[model samples]
Target: MAATALAGVALVGALVAVALGTYGRSHTPTGRPLALVIGFTDMAPMKAWLATAGVLLGLAQVLSAAWMWGRLPIRREAPHWLGQAHRWCGSLAFVLTLPVAYHCLWSLGFGTDSPRTVLHSVFGCAFYGVFASKMLALRTKRLPGWLLPAAGGLLFALLVGAWATASLWYFTQPGVPLK
Candidate 1:
């Protein structure tokens, strides 16, 4: 069962990558810059904030899963609230990715101008695909016990990959004033 779930995730991710890659790239501006960021007049800060939040929430999901699975340092089983925290964090992280993804797909589309850009585009597509698989695993009972964590871990890795390739790259640019 776990093997089946893993195969499903891989297939979904591959399909997403192929579909996004085949889509024509659009360089047109989105014209939907977020307003009011304490000294910024553009959407960059908002994008940065959302990406950061999503990454942090992804980290929280990983930690909570560790606790829930008895992989943490603690000897006792995780409390019930840990599960709730994991679910809420995962949901919020997924939600936060929506606007960023919308802007990326709507405004920039997928690109391969650079290694970072290519990585960002590929992982951006995979992130949603893995996320869907994770949510499905969460809802389905017939999947093996290991499948859920595997899906969740894949989602987290994809999120990290996307965030690092884009957000981290943006922040590291010289004289690009974060705020």
Candidate 2:
């Protein structure tokens, strides 16, 4: 049963990756960033802020997950509320990426013009694929204990990499506008 579940997850993740990558590669980039009015002047600033928030939340997810799994430095057991907090944080963090992802897919498309963009695109696709697998893993019964933590770790790493390649790069640019 565990093997079947794992196989199913792999297939779904692969299909998602292929579909996203194919569409992104075939779609023409608009060359205009999607302007979102989330308390920022333009899309880039808004995305930067969103990605930063997502990263912080992702970090929280990692910490909470570690505590839940008894992998934390301290020996205390995770409280009952901690599980709910972890789930909420994970959901919120995923939600925060939706706009940024929409903008990327709708406006920017898949980019290969630069090394950074290529890396970012790859990370983005991998992130979603892993996210799907993790969601499925959550629903599967009698799975190995290490699966969820591993998936969560991979998702967090991919998110961080994507964030660094895009948001971090944008912020480090010369004369970047805050608004």
Candidate 3:
């Protein structure tokens, strides 16, 4: 139950990050912040579509993580089908993230000299790397092994670190930087 709850929390965190990433967030960057740019700047039709995509992908990830926590009776035995759906959705989410990630790279001016921004870029790239590797493992029918689990573990850790830093800078700023 603890793991399930943590996964749920992570889900909520991901959703919040998606929201803040939207345009016209009304949140300004100050001090050594974690994110270089907020998502909602343009707030036009296209950006709004991207924002919607992000929200959907966030929901998908949350669901996938929840599955990993064993909340569903998908099975500890003879449960490969449901697990495949989760993997499929996760892969779809990866595809959705590409445009958003590219936008972020553009937003950051393609890694000029910002440490936090570069960290965000590195995390995003690594995050996608793990996702792809996990998918490859699943495709090769080599899942349920150490490699897949390790990839997931690393992804979760990166998720936590990135979202935590973003949260600290986004919510706790109170008009100050994340120190």
Candidate 1 C-alpha lDDT tens digits along 1-179: 66776667567656765665556264554555534344554567667778889999999999998988888899888887888888899889888888888777766778678998888988888888776667666665566777777878888888889999988888888877576
Better of 1 and 2 by lDDT: 2
| CA lDDT for candidate 1 | 0.77
Candidate 1 lands at a TM-score of: 0.83
Reference-based TM-score of each model = 0.83, 0.95, 0.48
lDDT of residue 92 for candidate 1:
94
Model 3 misplaced stretches (Cα beyond 4 Å)? 1-81, 110-114, 141-144, 165-168, 171-179
**Global CA lDDT of candidate 2, please?**
0.89
Clashes of 1: 0
* Candidate number with greatest TM-score: 2
What is the per-residue lDDT of model 3 for residues 15-119, given as tens digits with 9 covering 90 to 100?
534443432123332222223234533312232344345445555665565576665567654345756776576666556555555454444323325676556
RMSD of each: 3.0, 1.3, 12.5
Give a tens-digit lDDT track for model 2, residues 46-80.
99889889999999999998898888888778999
lDDT of each: 0.77, 0.89, 0.48
Model 2 residue 74 lDDT score: 88
Worst 10 residues of 2 by lDDT: 29-38
